[model samples]
Target chain A: MVTEIFFKEFHTPNNGIFLRIKDSLIKTRSKFQEIWVVETEGFGKMLLLDGKVMLTEEDEHIYHEMITHPGLSLLPEGMRVLVIGGGDGGTVREVLKHNPASVTLVEIDELVIEVSKKFFPSLAGSFNDPRVKIIIGDGVKFVKEAKDSGFDAIVIDSTDPEGPALALFSMEFYRAAKKILTQNSFIVTQSESPFYNKQFIVELLKNLKSEFRYVKNYIASVPTYPAIWSFTYASDSLELDVPPKRKISPTKYYHPNMGLDTTKEIVDEVFGCS
Target chain B: MVTEIFFKEFHTPNNGIFLRIKDSLIKTRSKFQEIWVVETEGFGKMLLLDGKVMLTEEDEHIYHEMITHPGLSLLPEGMRVLVIGGGDGGTVREVLKHNPASVTLVEIDELVIEVSKKFFPSLAGSFNDPRVKIIIGDGVKFVKEAKDSGFDAIVIDSTDPEGPALALFSMEFYRAAKKILTQNSFIVTQSESPFYNKQFIVELLKNLKSEFRYVKNYIASVPTYPAIWSFTYASDSLELDVPPKRKISPTKYYHPNMGLDTTKEIVDEVFGCS
Candidate 1:
């Protein structure tokens, strides 16, 4: 007897790596397109293009908060930030929350910006802020032209090692970053989930490890992404203005005190997996 | 610009209970049909029903390893066990690994038996044991009738509270549970996540306070479940089994040691929510 069955795979948001499994099967009209989205089902969507995960939805707070605060928060403080590939604009929004001098958001995809602005209202707020500058452009080429700039912090919110992000994962991009960043600048990017693409993440971490002494992997829960994703941070100086335990106000995400506490779990999962 | 957006609610399977959440428009492609079969854009599909979350493409051992081992490891002495609503019986298979005396499986749906025999090869092993007794009937009603029918432990593996479970979450259900067990019988059910669900869980716990002397919430990380959906254990006379500090077994879902350490966090979230 032949019957229809459901085969679902949990995957990394960055590459096509996934763990596929069966959830359920029913003989009926396919009324709904999807089954159900549970907390354990894992967040972050995986876009496998030519057998590679293109994007995983990093937790809105963990990745955005980490990418923005770690460097911007350390600036003694800076007012302006330039973001590349964060068409989602979540990182940009986190940057402006610090009351930055200004934010320049250079995104290649208008659709991503449109989607983030629509679906993720809290994240899109960064683009709407007067202090934010939304510029639709290529980050790799842009970084090269903006060398010796005085931006307080520069965040790379690109996708994984595909599309426009191919160059961002390379060292030339880091060298370009060094050219544009301030004396004690910070830089971070989506490093992908460890479960599906540990090799890719390790390679990225290794390359960054070779380039910077302060490169570190910070983890966070992304229910949608496979194995939860991590962000890689790199900088010249060790001294950073760690984000306060609490933000100036309340947030649905990013409780000030939890900022440092969540890092421990990140370290455990990372090293344990390693 | 009058660009419209959509936010859809989904009911995902977490063991038995449904983990509900509202997702925004970016999730245009459905993950799966409503039968707990998830079909995401790039990750393909997975079946998440029958209280077990196994990848459809991969073997069921991964999810089975975590779901069964964690609870069993906490109580190495468990012998006589009763599985509520496990018609497919993968859980019993995992339980049998410890070499228990007998396993009473109460499945409400008859089709589950027919389907399990045909589709699920790994799970069918649970029913093949000589010590296993299959009862095709209502778990809640049968349990109510099993007065003084002491069992070493009970695993509640029912479907979500859609229809059959309408009575499982009531005062009468727990009332019946008190009668069908020995003193040290540890009863564990799939508790909802503390994240998107605080108020709902608080109400359930509030009700349990009057029925059981001790009730504790524990969590396991399952990608299908957010932050790993929680589990609640209730006891009347004997001390609840404590979780191991380290995992003796290599499990994709749980290691033995995360218990008690995370107790405070789980308790705080459950109690603090209300």
Candidate 2:
């Protein structure tokens, strides 16, 4: 391993950012991909999957609150929620804050959960909640068989559409998610960087519009990420303009007014998509 | 000189991002600071002043357009303008698109102008416009003694508030700027990154609020910057809600609808400042 004052940049060959690592702790290969948890001087503990940053303790709230709150805020109270590919438990932690009846986390890699349990106990601790169920299987397969009427919201917190997470952004997966969502339910999936993944987002919006009645794109600026991160919100029945039914706690970034402002910017940027 | 495929990141000591440089081209020390012009694979030609990325060909439009358009759109018609510290001439180019009666650019460094003319002809070409008067002098001193009744818009496009540009953000300078402006005139200044320079921005807004009746903050996501780039709009008489008197062409990012949306987000994040 190369040790220097500055750490290796694990970004794609095209464009990338750097982090200063205080120490190298865990590095291992899982069945799905390579996993790492390193201590970063600037961003705290950072989780890396297949050499790409998944979460850092410092800015995870921005991603978690952004990915979960907007969709949950639009839904009715007390419900079952499904999270695909969020093995770190950050998304689950945010979802549970809303007092959901049940939260099912369908992460394909159990190794990610183990890493989180070891290096990120606070984040992974949510898995111990009585109402939480941990599933170690392919998210695509689980969503295919989910019941036709139970989930209030589905948050697809998958990595970039590569490796094990490729199927999560497919038309087949959106159809499956739509099938399992109850009336007034919504699904929000992590879209990649707007600067680098414009074509991918353009295609994803096109696919979602065909499967759902109303489609909205929301954006958040994650400092650890390359640029601005985006989330796609799709629903057939829920009116997005409707105020959030309940306020979730322990959030540092997500608020209704701020979310609405972001919504307008994202919608205008992708206006032609819908 | 180190020459390789990847470019060194000129970010701050605490945190920073990298750009893929095709080659290391120009590196020189001017009277003001170190200046560099390099070709990057992702962002094209980039200008770096004092080991910091200033602007790149790919995203310069986002910065120039966002800095100039919102304030210009709020103005009445072709009128006199003042630009402080925009030696690259990008801001002057954007200002010219509005057909202003005349533009007075006050840049402290003449070397910056020469470098831009040699390396960034497209950006610096606007200096040749008959309406432009390039003044090589201190911005703070120039604003303090400007004539009592001519300028309709003042754009402070300086670098960060750490160096010679320090005085530009002071309450004294703002008071001086307000003294020279016509009734409907407004001033817009680049306020640095919201994520990294929050405290600096908070202090700046406080200082401006002391001098201007209507103070509004706006932001734009420049992909190359640390995070979101911010601009401050301050006016004593203009109703910011007034629709733009005329349209400026050849803009890639700035539109009235999008500008309003960004204004909402920026204002909300800094609401606690006041």
Give per-residue CA lDDT, model 1, range A1-274, as digits (tens): 3222322332422112222323322122212111121112333332222332333343455456656665565565445678887766667767766777878888766655664565455667667777777777778888888758667677887766765578989988888888787766677787776545567776776677676767666545544445446667777775432334224322333333222212223334444541
lDDT per residue for candidate 2 within B1-274, as digits (tens), equals: 4334665663556467776778767889888899999898778889999878889887788789988987887775678999999999999999998889999999998988998998898899999999999999999989887888668999999998887888888888888888888888999999887667767877777777788887866667677887667888889887454235666676766654443323222344556421
lDDT of 1 by residue, B2-73 (tens): 212211123233212122222211111122112234333322333444423433323244345544555555
Candidate 2 at A263: error in angstroms? 12
Off by over 4 Å in 1: A1-83, A94-122, A127-138, A141-155, A171-188, A191-274, B1-73, B76-81, B96-104, B109-114, B126-137, B145-153, B178-186, B191-202, B209-244, B255-270
- Candidate 2's displacement at residue A7, Å, is 2.2
Candidate 1 overall lDDT versus native: 0.56
Please tell me which predicted candidate would have the highest lDDT against the true structure: 2
Worst 10 residues of 1 chain B by lDDT: B24-33
What are the DockQ scores of the candidates, in order?
0.06, 0.32
Clashes of each: 53, 0
